[model samples]
Structure formats: structure tokens, C-alpha cells
Target: MTSKSERLKDEGSRLQVTAAGATAGLISRFVIAPLDVVKIRLQLQTHPLSDPLTHRDLHGGPIYKGTLPTIRHILRSEGLTGLWKGNVPAELLYVCHNAIQFASYRQATVFLHSTLGEGTIPPSAESFIAGAVAGGTATAATYPLDLLRTRFAAQGNDRVYANLREAVLRIGREEGFQGYFRGLGPGLAQIIPFMGVFFAVYETLRPHLTHLELPFSTGGALAGTIASVTAKSATFPLDLVRKRIQVQGPTRNQYVHKNIPEYRGTMSTARAIVQNEGFRGLYRGLTVSLIKAAPASAVTMWTYERALRFYISLGERSVL
Candidate 1:
């Protein structure tokens, strides 16, 4: 049985972790918004032509064959603000998503530690399990915002969304309530393994890097970068499928086409991509995605760790 003071302390710690996670997520999303826009554009590119949607001239040869070309084209056509098209929803999603994730992760870790005992399981395994739970919980809570953000980011100037409310109401009216959860199956699937691998790898490598006498932030950043890259590479295909499903609707917005077969579910989406575009289709935006993930993960984890430490210090002082 825990004392009242101990329970209060634990609650304080959890709230602090949640705040740290939200701050980290907001800053990281803002830093990488441009790359995020580019990655979505690349992922939404299903045809091999200079489609107005993706701004890619697949037939224009080598110069247009990569991420840099895509970036240059977005800059030329839409200017700087274009890169942050969905920033509002993106920022909101991150704040809620990551706050829930880190808070749940800590709580889950506590439960697991108590149930399984500290020495009963390896720390890496414990972290992986806790991360999966946290990721799933967070994704379920904020998935609708995620879908809206993806659609907004992938949209061209063809349609104008006055605000987030308009977009939500439109999607609901057009696609039904299910529209909000469009890619939920694949999103949930991707996040579980994605977070499992991320936390496992981060926990495993962080201690080793810290032993090298690196600054705490530097060590956390490096570990996060490596973990994110690895997890993202492994789950890129699932992510692509989730994005595709999220953007499919009745609207003539970018990425949706009547000619293309509508995906019924996760496996169907995978089959469609593979059958139509080959295995490479699943990896379409992989390069830009990796570029975005590395720095975003670094900044997020570094900030999270630092903020968590600061909060913990404050708690300790208060307790004393």
C-alpha cells in the first residue's frame, strides 16, 4: 500500500512527464514541418508524371527524381508558407498525442514494474512493451486529427479549407463518421511496432552512449535519431498505406482518384500498392521521411529528456 504523499508525488511526476512530452512534440513538429509537407507530397504521388498535385515531373528525368527537386518545386510554386500547410493541426495533434504517449508510458512502466518485478524482465523488453501500449493509446485518442492533418498537408491549391473545424465538418459530412478513422487499422498497426522498436533501441543504446561522457542531451538525441531511423525504415510501407487511406475520400482533392481502386482495408491497400506499383511503391517517400525523422526525433527526445529532468528536479525540491 502506498502512502498519500507517495501517491501525490507519483501523480506530480506523471503530469510533469506529460507536459515535457507535449512541449517536445510541439517544438519538434514545427522544426520539421517543411520536411513533413514534402514527405506527404511524395507519399501521395501515385502516378509518374508532372501531376499538379505532387509537383513531380517523373518524365522530366534525373533532376526531378529525388527529394531536393520536390523541395525546390514546392518553394517555387507555393512559397515558404506552403511548407507549413497543415501546421496548426499538426501541432495540435502532436501536443495531445505525445503528452498522452509519455504519460501513459510512465504509468504503464510503473504498472509493469510492479507486476513483473524489476529483475524479472529486461529493461529493453519492458520499455518496448510500455511504448507499444503508450503508442496505441495515444494514436486512438488523436487519430482523427492525424487524418485531417495528412489530408491538409497533401492538398494542393485546388481546395481551400478555411479552418480545422470546416475540414472536420466537411470530412464528417462527406465521408461519414468513419472518415475520421480512415487509416486507423494501419496506423495502429504501424505505431505499435514503430514505438516498440523505438523505445527498445533508444533504451538499449542510450546507456552505452551516456557512458561515453557525452552530454545528456547529446546522448539522448543520438539514441533517438538512430532508433527513429531504424523503426521508420522497418515500418515505412505501413506508414505509406496509412497515409493513402487517410487521404481517400469523395472530394477531388489531391491523391484521391476515381480511376484508382479504392482500398477497403489495410491488407487491400498493401495489395493495391504492390500490385499497381511494385514493392517500391511502398517506399515512395522513404528518403524524405528519413530526413524528417532523424532531426525531429533528435530534438523531440532531447527536449523530452531535458524537460523531464527539470520537472523531476523541481519535484524533488518541493518534496524536500
Candidate 2:
């Protein structure tokens, strides 16, 4: 049985971890907001199934070409500010999402370790399961903000949202409450595997890399970047499906044809992409997605780990 002091120390550590996670999330998401904007825009790009010859022209034309071109176009058309569209909601989503996720992950990990005992399962497996649970919980809690962020980012300069309140009101008025959770199914599907692999890889690699004597932040960044790239590459299809589902509503621009029945739900969207555009269609923005995820995740995890270490040090000093 744990002593009272031990329990209090554990609680203190958990609180610190939660705060660190939130700070890391905010800074990282803000730094990569532009990349996130481009990635979402690319994912939301539509190709006409009825016209094979004009598909490239319609979907992959000058405006929605590769990442660099798309960036240039946004700059020329909407200026530097265009890159940071929806940043407010994105920041909110990240801060809340990470706080809940990392805190829950820590709690879950403790519970699992206590129940199963150390070494009963591999650390990597434990981290993976914990991450999945945390990710799902975080997604469920903050999904409304996430939907709004995606919609705002995908909107570009076409629609002006006065503020977060106005965006929420407009979505509520136009799409109803259900609109806030539009792509929840696909989002969870993607997040589970994405975060599972992410934490697993990070936990597995961190110890090995730490032996190299690199700074905590550097090691964290390296492990996080590699983990994020690997996980994102494997789950890019689900992300595309989620983005497509998220942008669907009466007020939003129709990325898919109204005539197509498969674009309506998660499974249907996957089926439609496979039927109309082949398997590759599901990986529409994989390159940009990976590019954005790697750096953003690196920064996020580095900050999280660094902040966690700082808090842990403080806790140790307090205990002393």
C-alpha cells in the first residue's frame, strides 16, 4: 500500500504533467498552424467522379497543387494571415486536447502498471493502449472545437468568421448540435491508431536515444518526429476520411457531389473513395500531412517532456 506522502507526490506529478502537456500543445500547434491549414485544404480538395479527364483540372489544378504552390497561392491571394486561419480554435483544441490526453495517459498508465504489475506487458504495448484511451477521451471531450477548427481552416478567406463565438453560433444555427461531432467516427478511428503508434514509438525510442546524452528536448523532438511520421503515414487514409466528413454541412462548400450517396457517412466515404478514385484517393494529402505532423509533433512532445521534467524536478525538490 502507498503512504499518504507518496500518494500526494504522485498527484503533484500528475498535475505538473497535465500543465506541461497543455503548454506544449499550445506552442506546437501555433507553430505549425500554417502547415495544418494547408494539409486540411489539400485533404478537402475534391475531384469530380463524373469527369475523369477534368479531374486533375478540377481538384489538383493551380490553386490546390503541391504544398509549396499551395502556400504561395495562399500568400498571394490571402496574405500571410491566411496561413494562420482558424489558429484560435486550433490552439484551444490542442491545449484542451493535450491536457486531457496526457493527464489521462498518465493515470491510465499508473492504473495499468498497478493492476498488471511491471513487466507483465511490454512498456511499448502499455504506452500504446494508454495513448489510445487518452486520445479517444480527449477527442470526445473537445471534438466540437476540433470540427470548428477544421471548418475554419478549410474555409480559407472565402468565409469570414467574426470570432470563435460567432463560429460556434453559426455552426449551431446552421448545422445543429450534431454538426459539432460531424466526423467523430472517422476522427476516433484515425486518432486511436495514430496516437497509439505515436506513444508506443516514443516510449520505445526515448530510452534508447536518451543514452546518447542529447538534451531532453532534443531527444524528445527526435523520437516524436520519427513516431509522428511513422504513425501518420500509416493512418493518413483515415485522416482524409475524417477531413472529408468534417467539411460536410449545409453551410460548408460541398467537396463531394450531392448525388453521391457514399459521401454521407464514414464507411460510405471510404467506400466511395475506393470505388471512385481507388485506394490512393484515401491518401490524398499524405505528403503534406506527414510534413506537418513531423515538426508539429516533434515540438509538442519536446515541450511536453521538457515541461514534465521541470515539474518532476520541482516535485523532487519539494519532497526533499
Candidate 3:
């Protein structure tokens, strides 16, 4: 039904979208990587970060405290490289995830607008569904890398599985294939709605904020902050659960978790945290997450849009 030129144009558009997503992920990953390391350590910790006494792991290892102190401890102990632990896997995970997410979202949007929602459903609802599908697809496709990243970040100086290659092989041999998907259920449950709200809020706010002409994209920053914080606040507990679950493999003893409960499922994990550590346990590293993710979200979306515009403009210039 479409001309050759139209088909080519569509392909180019998809490529541009994916490229933009990849660029955004690559750039933003470097921006908040250390903070992400901090988040994971906090998430995997079983005790209150507010405790005055340094909590000890089951192995009597020093459990990390609040963000700054934790950062200091890591630097004092593991050197600067500690902040970027798991960075390789984290980088790959983000690039692949953003590319898939944006590409799938574009396809889903087109499909819904032209086919499913044609003359029927509202655009807002379509955005919600499309965003959900996009996040879920990206998460499922790149889950192994994510699991690896979490595992690497959750550890301190006492490394487990050495590097990425060893981590993959040992996890495969020891825990089996299911080890790769250990936290996938909670991850998906969190990401699906998390991204749904994310895109919905972003789409709603971007137009208004981008046009405000505020210096350094204050509006865009505001929108991104609001979106990330709002969405994360709701799904953050599952994120913690996933981190806990991922480390429950054979190498579980490698890290310090202070007798962390073996969470059977998402709900059980939530219940265990509530019973043991109180409601606040669900939000251990939340401060750093909000600080890191909020700005990273803003930068990512802004960069993605800028990349998209740059690519599209180049395409147009070539055409002209």
C-alpha cells in the first residue's frame, strides 16, 4: 500500500528512533553509574541505613549506610573503580534496553494509531499501552544483562564471579538458565506500569515544558523529574525485591546481605521486608535513586529528543 520512498522513509524513521534511544542510554549511563551502584548496594542491604552503628553482614562484613557514607566507604575500601562496578554489563543493558524500548514504542504507536485505535481509542490510552509494551519488551529481551549488572553492583570489594564472562558461564553452569531470569518476574511487573506512567507523564508534560523556553530546559527537567519520581515511588519496592532475588543464586554467599530472606515471589518479598525491616525497608536507597534517576531521566529524554531531531534534520537536508 505504500510506495518505495514511503517504505524507505519508514525504515529510516525507525532507525533514527533506535539510534536516538541508544545514544541517550549510552550518555546517561555514564552520568549516573556511580549513583546506580550506590542504589543497588542499598537495595540489597537488609538493615536500616539510618542506623548509627555500622550493621554487619551474616559474614560480619560492614553493611553500607546512607548514600554519601556508602560512597565514602567504597572509595576508602575498593578504590574509585568500585563506583563503576558492573559498568560493562550496565552499559550494554541500557543501550540495548533503550534501543528496543524506543523502537518498540514507535512501532506500537504506529500500529495503534493506524490499526487498533483508528477512529476509536484516545491517544493517551494508546501511549499508555504502547509504553507498557515497550518497557516489557526491552526488559524481557535484555534481562540477563540486567541480572548480571545487579549482581556485579550488589557486591563490594569481595568480588564474585570475577568479570562478565565468568559471571555468565558460572551462573549458567551453577544456577542453570533460570538464574538469568531470577528477578525477571518482579522486574517486569515493576517496569510495565513504571514505563506506562513514565511515557504517559512525559508525553503529557514535554510539550508544555519544552516550549516554556526556560534556560537549560528547566521545563523538560521538571517533567522528567516528576515523571521518574512519580513512577519510581510506586514501583521501587519491586526493584529492591528484584535485587534481593537476583543475588539468591549459588554465589549468594559471596556478598553481604545479613541473612537476607530467600524471596519466593514478588509479594512474598514485599511481605518479608515489611515484617522484618518495617515499611521504610521498601525504600532503602530511595534518596539516591530519586537524586540520580530524576536528573538522568531528564537528561535521557532531552538527549533522545535532540538526537531524534538531529537525525531527522539530517535526513531532511539530504532530501532537500
- In order of appearance, the predictions have TM-scores of 0.88, 0.87, 0.91
RMSD of candidate 1 to true structure, Å: 4.4
Who wins the TM-score comparison? 3
lDDT for every model?
0.81, 0.79, 0.84
Q: What TM-score would candidate 2 get against the native?
A: 0.87
Please write out the lDDT profile of model 2 over residues 253-314, one tens digit for every residue. 43222222236788888988888767777887788888888779888987887787788888
Q: Candidate 2 or 3, higher lDDT? A: 3
lDDT of candidate 1 over 1-320, digit per residue (tens) = 78423553555477898999999999999999999988887777666333344433343211224788877867776688878989999999999999999999888887876787754777788889989999999999999989988877866555446679999888888889998999999999999999999999998998887545454458768889999999999999999999888877775343322233467799989988887777888898899899999889989998888887788888889989
Model 3: runs farther than 4 Å from truth? 1-12, 48-52, 55-58, 256-258, 317-320
How many clashes does the backbone of model 2 have? 0
User: Each candidate's root-mean-square deviation in Å?
Assistant: 4.4, 4.0, 3.4
Which scores better on TM-score, 1 or 3? 3
RMSD of 2: 4.0
Best by lDDT: 3
Runs in model 1 lying further than 4 Å from the true structure: 1-12, 48-64, 211-217, 252-261, 314-320
What's the candidate order when arranged by decreasing TM-score? Answer: 3, 1, 2
